[model samples]
Target: MIAVLTSGVALGVHVPGLLLASRLRERDVPVRVEVLERLLPPDRLAAVSASRDVFHRDFRVARVGQRIASDPVAAISADVQDELVRHWEECGVHTVVVFSGFWLSLVRRFMERTGRAPRVIVCHVDSVASPSFRKAGPALPGTEEIWLASRAGTALPWTIPVTREPPIQWDRREPRLLVHGGGWGMGTYRDRAADLVDAGHDIDLVVHAVEETGPAPGRTRHFVLNPAWHPWLDDGYPPLGHLLPGRSPADVSYTRGRTHHSSFDLARAVRAMVSKPGGGTLLDSLWSATPLVLLEPSGEHEGHNAQLWCDLGFGVRYEDWRSDAFSPRLLEKMHRALLSAAEGPRDLAAALSGSEVSLCSE
Candidate 1:
């Protein structure tokens, strides 16, 4: 059996593992997932549990303790070591696929003590310029690395995959836009939505915000928000009801109010996404061939991702969030880019395949 592992609350790390497990199950592959519980926030854990029915069938969940040291080669606690060993033996896991850098030391030790040293594959989900990739070096022998290159200029000695096209039918009716500010709500996007609404654009808006508590106008379903490391928004941002003007619900719908619904699934029908350049959301947009209307990135790594997005001609950036004019000329350009994305090759499955690991099929 194959085991997929991930740590931390970053959607970039967690969502990839979830998607991989789902893909494996779709192919009738036996798999299990292991997570480091202490590193994940409560909301992320809830998201993982919420997705269990759809993506985690026959998949077991295991938790390990958080690492106490900043060093990459630190030793794991006895409790964590024992739990992992039990999971490996019980599930008969012969190959380990990891999505986070934090688990590298633990995985290496586990392989050494178990004597059955499973094939280890590290899937780097972050941008090449990110600290995660820079610090990840001198990997144990027999370990392979897989990544999706953020920029053509950035090169790494690993398998770089193209974004995979999502396996969902598109609705070619009125174009729909998905508005999200990463996991935390972007207060500026509320104004951006108003600008679009005022333009008389015949489109549906699906907004994901932390302050929104219920459904609003334009078929906007309020998804419950998590703090998600955005302290300023959690502490100071006004409630959604106060920020957004009331309007009648639109005829269309995107999400059915599930808190843990996959963004990739939603992107299939969405013509464009207005979001911060978060790693997970960016990758999702690429795979769905959806155009991005990017807001200013939240961090240094996200800034690198934004540059790559522009370099690849995948999306356009809205530099000034305060600008009231939503240019029709810019919208046209975004639409053209969205159409162009579908013409390219997307080989995510081929990049993940390897000879050392066997994904069991029924």
Candidate 2:
């Protein structure tokens, strides 16, 4: 089987997709992540697989070499065809697991015609509030079904709502605070770091700092603000796409690095996690048992992500990270979560934990 992850998609979707794929591979089920042309920014995709320890073994991967700025769908279709032809001829692939948004007609043709092409499974790895909006429309005939990550509802092929496994209950060690740069570094991350320090939380800030944005200036014991934490977040990191501009550090990071041992190690670590209901990263925090100080990005997704966690009674949010009114809300929550960490709903915590992403074909 071959699994293809598209560009600019959600890490929540991809993490589970890859975990599922890995499980299949363990069963001697051959799996490969098809690198599509327009699916994502090449460098960003590379960074994700590279930073995560998952890039090992034969993996049977293929790369689709086309540019997205020109024509995204066409580039994706071309690459899929190329991979299909090669895999069909060499491996007799039995299935094609694709993670993407908006299906293309040409891809449908390849799935329909490829000899032993295998069942085509396409999953849209994004929050229901993703831009594409149309969730079920991208699925094709060969597609087994679409997997919905956030909500537990009627979707289709598979409906797994955040397959977060339980984490080993640690006795709330030192306050471990994890901050992500999303797929794009919004230049305001420095403020986040500053706020935590100002509040005397003594945080360990991890970010994938874009060169132009430089690094956050402050004193944190373990500050990792680089484009190298993608894979370790365990939530899967989405490709940066146009989110981060200029240099292509993501690809450089992925092609050369190994799996990160810590969460503070990638570009876009969390997707759309919502254990409490806001977004992917916050959920990851709950799963990792790390207390959170939710930063409100200007976008709806970030606000929604922040709100989810807040509603679930987990984390606190600040509209402006650089204000006198930053408040001690997050600090209070962290202490509370840590003190009663063992007493909280283990299921809810598990729902925030990370699962290896994989594709299914049953």
Candidate 3:
């Protein structure tokens, strides 16, 4: 059996973990996906639940807090730890894929306690670890780290396939952009969405809160993520609902696909995605063949992700596209580039089944 671990904090991280687990299951690999947040005690969980409010109010300060709290300050619940040990033993687990950083310490301790060292894959979604994995200090001594992002213009097959849908042909895509901040609604995407609308573009604006206003008269349509919902709240996708402007909140309803996150549902129809280069966003852009018009990154790792995407011709910076008047030509070219990459014969999950060290390295 294989253990796939993820944290609920970063929806970006959790989604890939799910995608990998799903793929593993298709290969008849028995996989268990455990969310680390389940080990958090009440107080720690409360703090995590409220973190989005802090991030929304002032991202910079929230980021500073992230740096200070990177190291494990609270203990993993003893009960959950005991439960995990028993479960892993029962499952006969031989490998572990950790998507979130904090899980490393707990996983390392598990290896020590059981005197059974499962091969650990430290799966990094960013071009490099930051905020999350970087916060955890480093991997458990011998764990192999995998970069899901492209490196040095070399496409390493680590990007997980989000959907089986063929990349929507460029001409068939709606003349609209899917715009949102990744996971917790971090970054300048809302403002960028406004600018895109002002520039006379159709938009599927993903607003974190219903209160985030946009002009309803134009081609801008609102999609609201339940403000109270966070990744840890459930294993499923964000609670997303298409908004009918001027309707009461009760009228909006959330829906999701069985296999992929609902955001990918929105992504399938858009011409491009205007957002920060989050790992999940990149995965979505890559699979959907949607060109990314990247906004200013929220952190250095994301900045690197943005650069890697641009370097590989999968994306472009917001300013560059803006200066060019948001040409469909720019998007179409990147769309073709992404389609080529997505059509690759292999992906991270398939490579991992063979336990190929080369897949982990480059």
Model 3: per-residue Cα lDDT over 291-346, one tens digit each: 89998877777888898889889899999998998888999999888877776635
Candidate 2 accuracy as TM-score: 0.56
Question: Between the candidate structures 2 and 3, which one is better when assessed by TM-score?
Answer: 3
For residues 6-114, write the lDDT of model 1, one tens digit per residue. 6534445555665666556555677776666443446754654444322212111211111112333233457757677777778888877877666666677677777
What are the per-model C-alpha RMSD values against the true structure? Answer: 9.8, 10.5, 2.2
* 2 versus 3: better lDDT goes to: 3
- Give each model's whole-structure lDDT: 0.52, 0.40, 0.79
Worst 10 residues of 1 by lDDT: 58-67
Off by over 4 Å in 3: 213-215, 354-362
Predicted structure with the largest TM-score when compared to the true one:
3
Estimate candidate 2's RMSD in Å.
10.5
My TM-score estimates for the predictions, one after another, are 0.66, 0.56, 0.92
Best by lDDT, which number?
Answer: 3
Arranged by lDDT with the best first, the candidates are 3, 1, 2
The local lDDT score (0 to 100) that residue 163 gets in candidate 3 is: 67
When summed lDDT is taken over every stretch of 10 residues in candidate 2, the lowest stretch is 58-67
